[model samples]
Target: MNLFRLDASILPGNSASAQLADAAEAEWTAAHPQGTVTRRHLGTDPLPADAWALATTASFTPEADRSPEQREALALATALAEELRSADTAILAVPLYNYGVSQHFKTWADLVIAGSDNPTEPLLKSTPTVLATTLGGGYGPGTPREGWDHSTPYLERLLGDIWQAELTVVKRELTLAATNPAMESLRPLAEDHHTQALTAAREAGRALAGI
Candidate 1:
């Protein structure tokens, strides 16, 4: 079996999203002790900012006239697409930043599309996928920031709709409550969210492993 893992947390050491993702991945690894895992850390080694554009334009330019940079970018896009195509299962750890998906992740998603054999095709095609996401503030129903979360929706559309993965999302909100003085009153809720997310992550992982 093959598993693909992608992490986009800029603060790896102290990331709430990573914590949840770890819980999920642990279950998967435990189930598939001998499975091959492919890993990508966008936070630490981001794709070139211009690679997506280059690859996109390269498709329009004839192969013979394409520049070296364009060819390289296109190759990278193909590789990214293949990672999803070949994975038996996948875990994506993406955090809500500034109320939306991070720039690096957006770039990665775009490049994957640009590299796909058919841009509109579903690369994952029902592959099981676990998405662990965290938010510093609450954005659930009736909260002050209700509907403020732009990240999770986009992720769902990409992994579930666009890629057509069998998706499971484990979300932890109010992650900043313990540290942000203004959110002290919400600490209890934050802790509860954290615990719930971890539990959900583990369940999602086991399911992803088909156990």
Candidate 2:
């Protein structure tokens, strides 16, 4: 089995999202000892800014009239698409920024998800996907903050549409509130939801790997 791990955290070090992704990778490696792991760090190595422009041009340009820029863009897009298509399982470490996935992730999403009008040419067809998200606040399906949760549902819908994959979301939120000693002392009843979520995520990773 081959796993593609995408790390989207913008932070340089000790990022919660990156840590979670590493945890998931570790679990997967443990389960599939011989499996190869491919890592892509979007924060450190971003796609070129003109990638979209080149893709759009290539989409419209005739083969004979296509410029070098357009050719390069199309080539890049094709490479990215091929990588995603070849992966057996994909683990995305998504950190919520302003209630949504980071812009870098969104750009990567655009590159991978082929948006053609043809119904048969969907981007990722039946690829397994796992989304691990870290947020400053807690929000989920039916909670009061659900309306503000732009990350999970949007990603779920997008990935489902493209890949037709089984989507699972493991969220860790409000770590500061949950782990702070002073807050724990003052609010003894405060739920350690972040820790629970992390534990759940680790188990989920193992389960996904069929361990």
TM-score of each: 0.99, 0.84
Q: What would the TM-score be for candidate 1 when compared with the true structure?
A: 0.99
- What residue runs in model 1 are displaced by over 4 Å at the alpha carbon? none
Q: For each candidate, what is the lDDT?
A: 0.93, 0.72
Instruction: Residues 92-203, candidate 2: write the lDDT tens digits.
Output: 8888899888888887777664324332344556666678878766575665677897887788877776566666677777645556665454233224665666776787
Among residues 3 or more apart in sequence or in different chains, the pairs in candidate 1 whose N, CA or C atoms overlap within 3 Å are: none
Clashing pairs in 2: 124-163
